[model samples]
Target chain A: MKKSVILSILSVFLITIFLGGCGSKDQTTLNVYNWGDYIDSSVIKQFEKETGIKVNYDTFATNEEMYVKINKGNASYDIAIPSDYMIEKMIKEGLVEKIDFNNIPNYQYIEDRFKNLEFDPTNEYSVPYMWGTLGILYNKKMVDEPVDSWDILWNPKYEKQILMLDSQRDSLAVALKKLNYSMNSTNDAELEAAKNALIEQRPLVLAYVGDEVKDKMIGEEAALAVVWGGDAVTMHRENPDLEYVIPKEGTNLFVDSIVIPSTAKHKAEAEKFIDFLCRTDIAFKNTDYIGYSTPHMEARKQLDPELANSPIAYPEPEDLENAEIFIDLGTYIEQYNRVWTEIKSH
Target chain B: MNKKWISAPYLVWMVIFIVVPLFLVGFYGITVRTDTGFVFSLEPLQRCFEPTYLKVLGRSVLLAAISTVICLILGYPIAMILTSKDFSDKNIYLMLFVIPMWMNFLLRTYAWLTLLEKNGLINVLLQKIGLNPIHILYTNQAVVLGMVYNFLPFMVLPIYSVLKKLDSSLIEAAQDLGANGFQTFIKVIFPLSIPGVVSGITMVFMPAVTTFVISRLLGGGHYYLIGNLIEEQFLSVGNWHFGSALSIFLMIIILISIFITSHYETDKEGSVGLW
Candidate 1:
């Protein structure tokens, strides 16, 4: 009797292993890699139902993590959404495939302003997905003074109540902008000044945070934080006391775009997914759900009137005059790394 | 089935998962790609000794040691209590200790974020009692608390097993020899449990030293431990050579620690047996 029971258990385990291996072998599967919490789940289901193609989705916390995986030639990802500078780096390194444009007919709905940017000069390699400016996200209840500039972050009165981005580029950009230098400055003197400024500001900082900035800000854990525009919008929805400002000193303007990796096994299916996302109604749903600015012109018109006109979501041209987009720094990234390590270790 | 043949699958698994990976880490640790090709270089390994990196290493060791000591202090008494003759329903207590571990470690740590937040459950309770809410999250104390809470089971289990198997006649003999309770514990029970203590310390210290998540979640990215430094190098900076070198340095530290602990364990046994 014991032997039969053991044999039954072994058979059950073997059946599970065999069945697990037999998942939708005949269907085309499109593997998508994107930023964490960047997409609506229902969209994936809609795409799958409409196209009859199985979708395998993955999320990455940072662009660098996605880049490392693709660069290593380890994973076969059909689509990836990386920031502008990283897209440029991947294009230079020949890690991405140029879109045929023939397959993505809905691309016409993309705004002309987002086209032919420095990242992809001819708009050959990527499709603009989301764009936003980096700025200070502050709680109005915590601070009494007007919050216009980055200097307020260094005020000793707000000591241990300020949070900074843990990312090297974003945090360094804040310090550089505060010093009245270009956010992308690679000059030794300017970079050193930025590094020193960060070191000086470190003591007052409660923490260097990433995605948790939204939660902490909403919980009133910190009075001030450096956050992206989209995250600031999300936090505002949660807590009405929060206010976002683009500092007078200027800040980093960024665009995250979708691209097909060179190692893609289903380029056609990936293109189909991209075109589906670019459709007006689908793009509206995504932009509204994720709380980021969309580059789709038709989708912009479809959004709520208040949100479509919000200065934070759709800033005027004059507001963006001082905003600078991040460009691929090439080997100079090492210098930034050294300075960041110094600041962190100190 | 022959015993040697039965071990074949595990041998293949070890080579593929353990030995090959270690060889690759060592290779990456000592070499750098250049115009000429992948050439041998000590620069990456030597960089591990730089002041900034050394400080990170020192901080990691200090925090891990603190957590291990705390675990030992808390775990020993629990183990003893569970194994005591007067104790009842020991299995239920053991089950309670093991239950939280079945949940994901990351989820457990994430739960702490909610409990320790400014407007979280702990602060809400404090406010109810008219006490000032404490800001304990995102501090070194929180990080150490996470480490001790997660690793206390490793300290408790081995010591419990050793004490359970211990001969009760030894205790009876010590009592008959007119030794008091404290003297009996010090001379007999504690000395015999040194092996379990050593294993427990090794298990707790190794994982504590290598953990990046607890520090990242609880330390609020304020503390740059060695694990975080390595993670930054590989993930953020794209510097695998330096990361591999740091990993190798950590492995050496762990090896040295295990060797010292085992040596101490055997030394204690020899002295106690002679007594």
Candidate 2:
């Protein structure tokens, strides 16, 4: 008798979920997948309120995670934000749809220079969302001298107080640049050298972290961290003692852009949302809130001169002299994986 | 026989959730897709025997074994004290032990990060006491500490239940037979509780062996256990084939350990002889 009762209760729960799933098909919704903490959520509220289309926003920590989700094709996302090399891979793999610029009047607001980049050279598939430099974020009080190069990361004085990015590509890129090799070096000797550099630096590193770098730096848990320019700006706001610099050895310049996956069920609504985000006012709000470099010319002009002129946010041309954007490594990524594994295991 | 129908939902759930996924993992583990079509390949399995990966597997086993041993040492005493009739406020003490388990395991592990960080609470306390702060976070020690902290309750609960049910007459008889307190415990209580100890060790060791989050957060990515290696293959490298092979490899290790533990649990004469 008790088993019968439990069976009936389980049936009731399953039926409830099945019926609830069927009921949600009537409402129009656009799913937007972006990196964690990438957006000003207030804009999502405004977009939903104005468009009468429900917005289902989701977050991922890395491009690889986003790729796996999209590759699985389980949940249909109307829009996604992926980085430069990933965008290239998605285009080659036929995973994304080309944007209809005619539907997006605000495309004119995007700066000309942001257009026709190597990732989307034809300006067909993606719209630049946010761009930034991979650099060092150091606490002024903890360091004895000026922190302008990647060499400081290897300095024994700051032993056990250094935090490195946990990402394979970014961390490997740091070691590569520090050794005066190309960030995209595929040669075995260069890769091995980079691996050894990291293995040597491992003892001094406090931790390899991802998004937690911001909080740890803010809490004064680490003396230095390798972080993106945008997170550095956000962290600096929370703690003025923190400073950001693109090291003299050079670093990665990454651009994350908005694109629609081909599997999108709500193409029109997705386009509308993209255009809404690109509106000068909306774009300015996001740029200001996220503290990332904006690609919208009108939005950039609207920013405070102090912020727009800040070296960290808008570095002079010389600071970018050695910086290189990451390209899709394609099959060569396996080599990177092996080298990273070696470094980590060693 | 009619009552057996009540388990239908659970059987269906298992087929869909467990059996199907396992089949998929097995399918991917031994095959690779080529430009033409799918091909049977032992490459993924062969890669698992690489010296580098073998070393990682050894490290994972070592760390997990250490944590399991530590949990046994710590948990056995607590279980004993709790099950003791002479102890007062046993319920309250058990409740206190279980409070940390009530919080999410990830949150509990993260709390350790806050406490063990160089400039964190533990360091601050050390400074207050006029002692130099120790760097414990992001080390093998910290990873082991995390495993023990998270899985200690798993060890305690099972042993505690068994000890609570233990017949005191056996102890009394041992005393009557001229066995002292330590002798009674060694020959009688410990042997009788082998089942619980086996279960607790299994519970602690399994999760400790397979955990990626603790090693990622506490080991600082410098230390790559088998769990971390598997995670890297699947998540970052996007090589599901190799990841599935590694997972199968891990399952075999766990199954072997469980077998060894159960052997000790069942062999009453063999275990009691050790005393």
Best by DockQ: 2
lDDT of 2 by residue, A100-187 (tens): 9999999998878789999999989999999989999999999869988999999999988999988889999999999999998878
Residue-level error in angstroms, candidate 2, position A291: 1.1
User: Residue B163 error for model 2, in Å?
Assistant: 0.8
* Model 1 Cα lDDT, one tens digit per residue, B62-165: 99999999999999999999999888899899999999999978778888988998889999999999999998888899999999999999999999999999
- Residue by residue across A166-210, what tens digits does model 1's lDDT show? 888899999999999997888999999999999999889988887
True interface contacts reproduced, per candidate: 0.64, 0.74
Q: For every candidate, what is the interface RMSD in angstroms?
A: 1.3, 1.3
Q: Which candidate number maximizes lDDT? A: 1
lDDT of 1: 0.89
Alpha-carbon runs more than 4 Å astray in model 2: A1-24, B273-275
Question: Lowest lDDT 10-mer window, candidate 2 chain B?
Answer: B231-240
